[model samples]
Target: MIVETTRPATTRRAARLRGALLWAAVAPGCAWAAVRLGGLDRGPLVQLLAFTPYAAAGSLLPLLLALALRRRGPAVVAALASAALVAVVAPRALPSGQPPAAGPTVRLLTANLLAGAGDAGALVDLVRRHRVDVLAVQEFTPAAEVELQRLGLDGLLPHRQLSPSIGTVGSGLYARFPISAGGVRHNRGGWGFDQAHGTVAVPGAPAIRVESAHPSAPYAVDQVGHWRTDLAAQPPATPGGPLGILAGDFNATLDHGPLRALLDTGYVDAADQVGAGLVGTWGPYDGDWIPPVTIDHVLVDRRIAVRSVAVHRVPGSDHRAVLAELRLPAG
Candidate 1:
């Protein structure tokens, strides 16, 4: 007996509806991947690809929709597309099997204080919890500086280089070891584009050069050049020389051309080296719906190997703080 039971029109329509919805959701993801892969971002469009990595999350929507429709082909296609997105953003999400540097490890935390608006106690608590050896703060302001001191940061780290606030430029670097202040170095745009530099002498290891980098934000059209030029002007974190640690809010991302150039200079982003680069480090500022972005970075010379990385939320600041445990070459 040949029994033919055809599917109902309603079921067919529902399946088509689900498939349509799934494709619609995935369209933007495909577009973002195209822009990222094409490398078409330039000038005003440069920051466009910076947020493409976030689209990786959207890829799951298609898979879910395909499941509702019981469509195996769509499920496979959506999954492959999502995997492609992750592959494109790799090195950020990919693991590096390179062995850690020989000798003791140093934990470092770099954060932007949102013009000293972050919680002093929270920042101090973060330091204590992590037992961070070096702390680099951007947008460091007088109020924030005093609060840190009152919260026992000065007593904890002792050595310091706190600068005066000049727009969103003031920065501070505090360490348990002695710090040789290097004065505020102005970037291409000066004032707001300033970075605080210093040299820190660790117990037995060689001294490390630290910079609280806060280049001018490219949020405005006029600041685009300033941002690019600033990143370009910064020196490379070449190994063999004193281990250089460039950390803080770069206001830039790995997708950014200028930042990629900086990384090409024999320096490696600690977070990126350990699969934590995809984590968002900015957002939730004002009323704007800002998605978290990895604008914060801890760039270390090749001599220093990344051990582990982390990101944390601090009240008051729009950006999250990033920390990395780096193993340095034997002195």
Candidate 2:
């Protein structure tokens, strides 16, 4: 005869507690993804909280969850709650407009014309059509610069600051208004491209400080951490001003930690400000299965009001252009 034995109450309680802890650990990632989906501002703290599990994936959390709670029902429920939170919060964060009463509205266009992109002529046409007030270009080659000038952009926009470094394959800022002082940052990396900043005179309005940055692409976990550190060290060149703007190929998504840090500094993203849906700027050159990412961005300080923001498709570059119209508050 065999005796039937039951597990002790302590064992059952321990298993349940373990399951609850595992579920809690996985819940934050779902919340993070949901925040991004709901268009809520993902700050550095949020990113840190969300990415901890993925960063420490080699540990026991996933393994235990797989062995004990294979169903993942609790995880699914947590993710759904996170998504619902995003839906509730996104609408309220958007900016509200009064009327079109404007003093000087600056229409700026920022583009990352890929180094070898063959669509320079198409880009020129776009500039003329849009009547762009200030144009900030990244991945700007010397050859492209000459071609752009030949296409009559120089005539349209006389004031300019170009750092066509062969070593860096850098950026160029061309403006319709006079540029007071402009220079590239001293920091140099493996890519050799330095950050570019300038002050553009807006006539009756305040001078706007603009920075064109192309930080290293954070494809790996370490790279993402490095980007965060670099961004924190190098702040925008907003010299005692109420208005500042930074626009370029940030090389990171809105969900990324470094980008969130930039947003937390009281600067409003022009795309989010205008309520434009997620605008994907980067695509594979050969058009592969890789999904498009919105690595490009235009962020403005709170004092400067955003009228509208749009992404313009340029023919040759793998990245699209971001156009933003900013309204300065009445004096």
Badly placed stretches (over 4 Å) of model 2 are: 1-76, 79-81, 84-102, 116-118, 186-190, 237-242
What are the per-residue Cα lDDT tens digits for candidate 1 across 173-280? 888888885677877663455678888887667778998888877776667777777888887876546779899988888877788788888788888888888888
For all candidates in order, the CA lDDT equals 0.80, 0.67
lDDT of the structure predicted as candidate 2: 0.67
Report the Cα lDDT for residue 79, model 1: 74
Worst 10 residues of 1 by lDDT: 1-10
Candidate 2's residue-wise lDDT over 1-331, tens digit each? 1232344566778878877787767665465555554545333443343332232232234434545666467655544544444453343246555334355888888888777363778777767888888888888878888888888989888988787654335788888989877987633333544567788888777777787777755455545555555555455434345567888877765555556677777676788777763556777546596556667888777677788888888887888889898886553
Candidate 1: residue pairs that collide: 281-293
Clashing pairs in 2: none
Can you give the lDDT of residue 245 in candidate 2? 81
